[model samples]
Target: MSEVPEVRPPTVTPVRVVIALCLIAPFVAMLWVGSYARTGPEFIGIPFFYWYQMAWVLISTALTMTAYQLWQRDQRARAARKDGASK
Candidate 1:
């Protein structure tokens, strides 16, 4: 009877850390509501709180894209390593 080897998850690299941060940014921003809960600073009459969330919408989009790119690179690297190991 042959035993099957367990497949471990890929190791985290510096690039992956950056991707994690990029994904976490929006959650951190919205969670810390006190920082932007104000009206004095307005963009075209939009309240700070409202504008802040809206701004995060765009920022989150960019960050998500960056994170996704990083993830793709990591996956490619892992796949290459797996292929090389199997040969």
Candidate 2:
């Protein structure tokens, strides 16, 4: 009889935690409406509420890109490790 090896679930790593934060930050910021639902602090005639949301658009794009890059790097590292272990 051949016994099959057990497959363990992947553990949480710091890289993954950082990646999650990068992805979640924008969502958390925008969803917490009370934090930026004000009209003061105008920027060049634009209300703070308007500019803040617009700024988050760019910030979200950067964060999303960063998360994607980190994910790609993590995947490549994982693949290398898997190949090395199989050999």
| Highest-scoring model, TM-score | 2
Candidate 1 ranges beyond 4 A from true positions = 1-10
Query: What are the clash counts of all predictions, listed in order?
Result: 0, 0
Off by over 4 Å in 2: 1-9
TM-score for candidate 2: 0.88
TM-scores for every candidate against the unseen true structure = 0.83, 0.88
Residue-wise C-alpha lDDT for candidate 1, range 1-87, written one tens digit per residue: 996685666577788899999999999999997899888688999888899999999999999999999899889888887887677
Point out the worst 10-residue segment of candidate 2 by lDDT.
3-12
Q: What is the lDDT of residue 27 in candidate 1?
A: 98
Q: Report the number of the highest-lDDT candidate.
A: 2
* Local distance difference test, candidate 2: 0.90
**Model 2 agreement with the true structure over 1-87: per-residue lDDT tens digits:** 996574433768898999999999999999999999999999999999999999999999999999999999988888887776666
